[model samples]
Target chain A: MATFDLNDEGVVVIVGSGAGGGTVANELAQKGIKSVVLEAGPRFDSSDMVNDEWGAFQKLSWLDKRYSAGGWHGAVNHQNLPAWIVKGYGGSTVHWAGVALRFKEYEFKTRSTYGEIADANIEDWPVSLEEMTPYYEKAEIKMGVTGKTTGMPHLPWNNGFRVLAEGCRRTGRTDYDSGPMAINSIERDGRPACQQIGFCMQGCAIGAKWSTMVTELPQAEDTEYCEIRTGAMALKVEHDDSGKVTGVLYADAEGNQQLQKARVVCVAGNSIESPRLLLNSASAMFPDGLANSSGQVGKNYMVHTTGGVYAAMPEPVHMFRGTSVAGIVGDDVYHDPSRGFSGGFYLEFLSLGLPFMAAFMEPGNTGWGKSVAQGLEQYDHMSGVWVLGEDLAQDQNGVTLHDSEVDQYGLAVPVVAKTPHINDVNMTNYMFETSAQIYEAVGATDVYELPAYPASHNMGTNRMHAEASKGVVNAFGQSHDIANLFVSDGSQFTSSGACNPTLTIVALAIRQAEYIAQEMNAQNI
Target chain B: MNGRLSIDVYQAIADGVSAGADADEANATALKAGLGEVVAQAQALFGSSYVDIPDDDAREGILRTFQNEGFFQGVRWAAYFGIYNNPDVWLKFGYQGSSVEHGDYIDRGFSDITFVPEGPTLEERMAQVKG
Candidate 1:
């Protein structure tokens, strides 16, 4: 960890070290700009990746035993599973299952398609797919993503692509073309190519996948001007009378609060904490909170209402032999209103459930010792796919400060309130039917449908829109009210496009980093 | 006066409220009326000798209801092991032997044993249950 005097200046403070912050830090450091990235979690590497399920879950998760979704109201008392969102130096990219897809062109212009969803503050994104095309190219090549996908400006063509494309052709669904992913089939940077080990979600013990700890952050460290400080929690940005970022107030590991001066501050914590930090920084001048002049700091929360279908086969499928997700079926996403819904979905084969998780997910009839033993015997024969769908951007699904709940830092905990749109429900049911049909197509018997509530992706909180009233961030992901402050995570998504968000997230991060770098060089400050 | 069971009615009300019953606000008016009938019945049964009694049945009933309801079975195995394996808890509930003996208890459905280890904890050759 690097430490600097509070009086020092000319440093850019990036709040998170995840996909967005890590990318931004690397880009800035390469431009000969000094940066100080403050991450709340500890720094870890491939060696730190644990083998046991519980150990792996701890290394790669944020929500813990103590944290709850504000204890069951409109906020369901649900335990968020150990999803790909990582807590270490690499962020989520470390443990990601590594299936990435870009959003479709129409996902940008949602208001035009859905005709202004009821009670939703929907707006067309100021930037389009064309504008972000180059950044997407740079990110794909930099991260060494494999598989040829259609509807993108640049990428290689591969066997997975040919198979999925042929499958789509056979089904007569033109939209079923395979999209490019971030996982490496053949190595692209200095790292070795993937051996196709299925435990990519367990943090890739061998660094075949590109986590920031091995990729961008290491490069940023070599630059000498960048200071990476893990276990440092940034509380708020302190501004002078001119309203430009002067420094940041943060706490150390031992609960000691301190200040670090900076020329600029960019917050890149994921949708949950990024908005919470801004709301917690309330002052007399900004009663509602900093960078919240429109008072939409934590509004329009969207998590793709993720559900799935799991099936048992007669023989061992060896589901854990390759990547957690090898292929995707994206034919279902479109602007069609004839299906009596506003949104749609995509599908991909998911990893096999581990022993304990499989035992728990088994039906209620098989709960005792005999039943648990029987379920364990059928572990290898199971395989499934996720039904990743879009959630309507609604005002009702928002994050607010829970007055009664205080975290370990004495700050008010973020209370998330979610109410699924009727369209979301309809689209969810549609996806269940589609999943069953696809499973049947793939010759699956004894299939079961998973319910679609308590969505996992967790996106679209700090939405980007053309008008300041409609969103918290501008088209370039800059805070509309605070000139020097910016946001760069899934929070800036306008619509939850019916696909996994990492490819889009990485592309957006690259674009935003470029925008910031160009503006800094032009002396726009 | 007499050895009467101490019935903590307040505890029963609290338990009822926590279990999501209509005891607190929903039946407050009815409870106020029903107290008079119980008071008169108590006085008629043992005049000047009536004493407050603890309702051991309520405590036992709560435990039995939890067992019957099958709540927190699949979930919270951590809490289950915490109470289930503790020897003091087994002794209080009138069960015998160590955690290894739990299998036998499961089969018998009574969790009782004839002999307990004794005599200064010297147990290498103890033959208490051998006969």
Candidate 2:
């Protein structure tokens, strides 16, 4: 509820108040530093949250004009909407299933561990897992993730999860759990425990899920040092002649342009928009883009290699009766070159409403075949797993500004070009076969393989590298060229590890906040 | 209500398209208004009498003419949303609608398992994995 003046040059300006920007705002505010968070979407509290899937999607999804290219199925299927990210106050966190996971040590060093994958531009994270452990713990504690940090027990197994666990056991796979979820199994912080409404992705209507809209943004405002300006779309990061970011030029709620001066600018507008903003901010001093001295600003875009495997059991599984993604089998989430792929994946339990199942069970606009209809008819008897794995970053697969197309904001629409690598194809095949086998070992009558939905875990557009020539940002998410500019979102990911990116994004933001505070106190900028 | 496709026509299309779906179960008024614009555009593109074309094959042919158009996608999505979320449709498909508002079935049926187990319980499996 706090408000800051547009001319306030002393505040840190954080764009996109989601997992990253919202966390950064709260962390900085806790450090006695003032910040102004500019969220491009409207503010919606729990009152606005709904259990209806399509309704929540309309309220939360970023439906901005974007183009998709490259050989990825998304290009042909979801041509205009390549990513299923949110645009509102909490960003995608509003719609997240809250599977909080940390990248393994080997995952942090993908480039070093999985050496010389052809056509992949993989790189090791400048900061190792060892460096991120403390921050990850801090994030787990802060987000109330169900694990050792919090004494809260993991959620009880729903029927859907029971089916998945049974299948895993039959297949000789181990290492499955109901959590590490950010959703509350018991009430903690100021939020209530999850009612297991089975609508976690549709913006937890009861505030059981940790979202910046209900958590960080409010806590930051309680400090009276943070001002969250909703419906403010950041157009460009304005910089001075000396290459220091001065402020952000944004279009306000009424479509009027305004410049909010800042001592520091943190871009956390998810992966696509974070890089798109930089690409759009091309100036004489930095003609290529802001923080593009290495020409890696919008390169190496990665959404995890993903697909879905669902099986129709003879009995009523009622997969949609509990949490959407509470169970995960992590035995396959390790790197073993013997598997014919460099990286590995996790088979996480996932359930979709009948409408979404009908739409996304197959690709293209309309999934009207007999197989698709029968699959929808058997919704109650189905249990599924979403295959989430490490997606190798390729230099050619990235976000680029379209030449001719313009959005309603008069900016060139971002063209998200992505094509699955040979490794991705091989890995997906293995996952599909393994999943089908597991279900078959259990009592599955029919199995369905669904292609990847639009990019859910968008990462690696402004990646971190120890060497300035290899990446756009440094180990601390600070731009090498502009000391005061930072990429505090999933866009700063070096590699797409075989886990969900929210926990990592939050941990990195917490770490980045400490660095930014220390640097500002020392007047390093 | 968008002045192109009437509610009756939209309901008829919905009933005709969806197998075992009742026309009254769908949100006919809303779908008619929402999908009316798209239906108008389809009519404009294919022919003015596209909606009134009585023959099922001729209507299918007309709809196919605008397959790549946003109007067609809209009409299809409208039918999907209307038919899928209907309570009667859910009953027919054996889908127990939204459980969150009335508390989860955690205590009621979440732990009920009738199928024979191929391996140990999840806890035992976890213990074995840990070892």
Candidate 3:
């Protein structure tokens, strides 16, 4: 591991070594630019990963002090932990299920497509799908996403997916298949093929799934220009008198404070922490936050409108025998305003281990009793689908610093405030009913509707906009107020498209790297 | 009474909560420390004789009363990890433990579905959609 001096002011400092930060670090390193990646969690290799869900969760999940508010179920159920993002060297990419998807063209122009939704702050993305296509191709190829530029075949249909596919067939839905996933179906990129681990969310033990932990971070380290410092929690982004970010003040592993100087600073700490860090860095020059001239740093938070539906088959399905999310039914993933809702959703096959099934099968932790026990007893016969729908961005839903509570690092705890829009409720009801109907069409004995898990696909806090007054960052994720500061994570999402956000995050990072490199050569900072 | 739960008491609670599954056969020592904390909390809430209550209905009622409590959640979560993660319990539930360690079920049974209709091959589907 290469270590750089804290006074190295020429290096770029990237916070949170997840998808965006890790990819940006490697891409910059490949361009011969030195970077210092400060990750808030420990470094763990594939040898440190486990197949057990709770064990892996303890090893990877960000258990920091964060409060939840508003009327979202997570506020009451998962009050202390509103999101399921990781805080490790690779961040949540280590725990991702590898459902790689690109946003549709219509999804990019949501404000124009679904015009004037009540009480929503929707906007069109500054960058369109046409502009993002080449970057998406590069991201897909680099991540070895099956069924895309890699041309590797999609993973085989597991029994759980077969059950869902059969149900979709009976319901006359034609757009369902094993999804385009980043998990390897055939050995490529020097990684082994997925061995049907059934524990993709618990960190792919064999490296078949492409995570920045295994792919980008290690390759960045090999470049000798990139130094990844684990257990370095970024406290604030410090700026000079002229309002340009110059360095980051972070807490080391031993709770000692340190400052690492940088010419450019990129905030890639997911959505919540990215905004929280900016909010925490408030100074006299920038009273609102680092790049909060629009007061939109942490506004318009979104975790895809999500829920789960599990049905019991008469015969054994062994849903846990294969991948956690192997297939997707994209029939409903189009913008069909006729469905009594503006946005669309995807029904992806999901199979949780017994512990999570028992814990999260219902809301508020009341998933006990004889009925719940009976569901667990029929675990082998249960097949399920996770609903991923587009959540309209609303300015009221956001992350804010709490009034009194402070974390272990003495920073004000972030209170994630969110309330499901009526559109979200309507879409979730439609999804649940449609899923139940599909299962019933295939002779399912009983169906159980599971509430949304904690935010996994978190997005949109430091969103991109064409104008400086509308959002915190510009099209290329450069902060509108601070030229040298950037928001490189899902926080830069303009709209919460009805797809997994990791691929979009990677594509945007790749595109941003080129812009950053050009700006550096031109001495723009 | 150092407030530690005994093996027998843990077994009884495990059996009572396992919904008639053979939870007693699973190891309790691994969870002894955590369950002991739960037992201390339960004792503080329902008194020491709560574990010795004769009627199953009464015992279940007490457990249900503390359903949302931390002690109950702790006990239930610990029991779940202890009981469900056991190889014996996995066998009883027909779960094949950790298929990746042995090998993927690709050639064996991943696609040997009897109930579902076979979808078109990936290449065929891609052609139809892209074309």
List the DockQ of the predictions in order.
0.01, 0.21, 0.23
Off by over 4 Å in 3: B1-66, B69-79, B85-88, B118-131
Which stretches in model 1 have alpha-carbon errors above 4 Å?
A1-4, A64-84, A148-179, A359-377, A452-456, B1-71, B74-131
| Candidate 3 chain A worst ten-residue window by lDDT | A362-371
First chain TM-score in every candidate? 0.89, 0.99, 0.99
Per-residue error (Å), model 3, residue A76: 1.8
Q: For candidate 2, what is the DockQ?
A: 0.21
Candidate lDDT (C-alpha), each: 0.62, 0.85, 0.86
lDDT for A379 (candidate 2): 82
Determine the iRMS, in angstroms, of model 2.
5.5
- Better model by lDDT: candidate 1 vs candidate 2: 2
Off by over 4 Å in 2: B1-11, B14-78, B116-131
Error of 1 at A468 (Å): 1.1
Which model scores highest in DockQ? 3
Tens digits of lDDT, candidate 3, A214-246: 999999999878999999999999999988898
Q: Is candidate 2 or candidate 3 better by DockQ?
A: 3
**Sorted on DockQ, highest at the top, how do the candidates line up?**
3, 2, 1
Clashing pairs for model 2 are A197-B100
Q: After superposition, how far is residue A490 of candidate 1 from its true place, in Å?
A: 1.2
Error of 3 at B106 (Å): 3.2
